[model samples]
Target: MILAPYYFNEKTNLSEQPYRNQKRRLEGRSIRDLPLYSQELLDRIRLPAERDLNDDPCWLRTYYDPSSEDSWGQIQDYIDTKIGGPVTVYNDSSLYNFGSNWEKIFLRAPQLLDNTCLFEEYEEYVEEALEEGIESESGDAQHAGENGYDPVEDENPWICFYSEYLFRLAAGHIYIVDEKTLASEGPDAGTVLVMWYDECGRAIRYYREEAMHAAEIANLAPCYLKDYACWDNAEIGESYEWGAPLGPPYGENRREASE
Candidate 1:
């Protein structure tokens, strides 16, 4: 019942235009929390690869217009149609993989993915992008987050996103890192990382703890956590072993396991 994922809202899509904005979606939003989904609920989704994602409004654009909110709502409706109830989703990446310019590439579909992907790249790109530096058309990424820029549209409107992050199973305890916004009123808001695990139990890693975008989730259970955290100490050198560092690009890893 690990509930980690990159849920998207339809309105989160880039403005329907030729030019791309700087606000790449899903830039940074990873955290650590206990298993919210019940065993029965987890069982409902039999697919080892199927982790659920929902509307993840970015911290910058906290307030969504009615239209945008409604678009996000539609994604929820679709989820309800399938699972029936406020279903919980286990995300594929680590706590660090949340933030990035790549989100814009993955928006508007069942899942998020690597920014640069081809046939089976999404399946592999998510993990691969983390290892190297991207030559962003818009070089100012720090501004990209603050300036509201998004990844340029992909070749296929239907084929957005690199791919859903793959999952590796680990076991341990859970940690939580919840963010609090001070807004402009208080001191500049900063993030807080919390570790949730049995005092007696051994500690673990939060999935996707490498992206540098997400903060740390100390003491979380490694069991069920994704082993290929976006920004873990593990380094991706000059060469690649398999396809992509993270997942199957396009043609691979598409089908959701039967629930």
Candidate 2:
């Protein structure tokens, strides 16, 4: 769908550390108190699992900003030209279902088709994995007993509700490109590049420091898709129980049953 341009205004502040502000907004809330969205939607928009991007070789964290009023106008123009054409923009509130992580434009292209084109359409498969992490100091202090050990206090409690955010095309025609790599090579390496594209995909007319005026890089690959197989061979067994047969159906040994 074409997002209403009215929603794109000066008030919109794009930040790389989106989670920091969102966590602050929901400082004391529990998972039960969080807003609701389909698990499918969360799977599409949520950030990559720690196992995916945490150790990936291509992973780089950077930010980009439009330098001047003229630059902002150019970016806006680019988005405007793509709408109301054969191209479709897959932008719905569904993309921003994860609390305030997404700053969606309120009034844009609503005429476009509202379908699963935003990302690859996949059948629903719910798999639950338990995540463990070290406890924060505050958590340790909160439940710490005078005794030497506190089972609850010994480890920090955290819940990984969903897997990492995989980059999906909005209606198989649009993409939000992270131009940090290009910006790093340009004049302002510290700034991040957050550019939205149309059916032309990855083609953005923006100022690259190496160039005098705005330039366009078309047909950029979608690197946001992670390869899950990287850690699949690590032999991390399916269960916490020791030597309990290697795969799923952890309860009884089939061989023992046959005997």
The candidate scoring highest on TM-score is 2
Consecutive 10-residue window with the lowest summed lDDT within model 2: 123-132
TM-score of each: 0.17, 0.21
**lDDT (tens digit, per residue) of candidate 2 on 1-259:** 1111111111122331233345458678654454566544544544333112111111112213443334434343543452322222222233422222212321122111122233322211111121111122223443234322345553411111111111221212122223432243555432223332222122111122211111122212334322222111112212211242222121222223334
What is the per-residue lDDT of model 1 for residues 2-23, given as tens digits with 9 covering 90 to 100? Answer: 1111111121232221111221
The number of the candidate with the highest lDDT is 2
Clashes of each: 54, 20
Q: What are the RMSD figures for all models against the true structure?
A: 20.6, 20.5
Error of 1 at 159 (Å): 19
Global lDDT of each candidate? 0.25, 0.25
Indicate the residue-level lDDT of 117 in model 1: 18
User: Stretches of candidate 1 above 4 Å error?
Assistant: 1-67, 84-86, 89-259
Q: How far does residue 117 in candidate 2 sit from its true spot (Å)?
A: 3.9
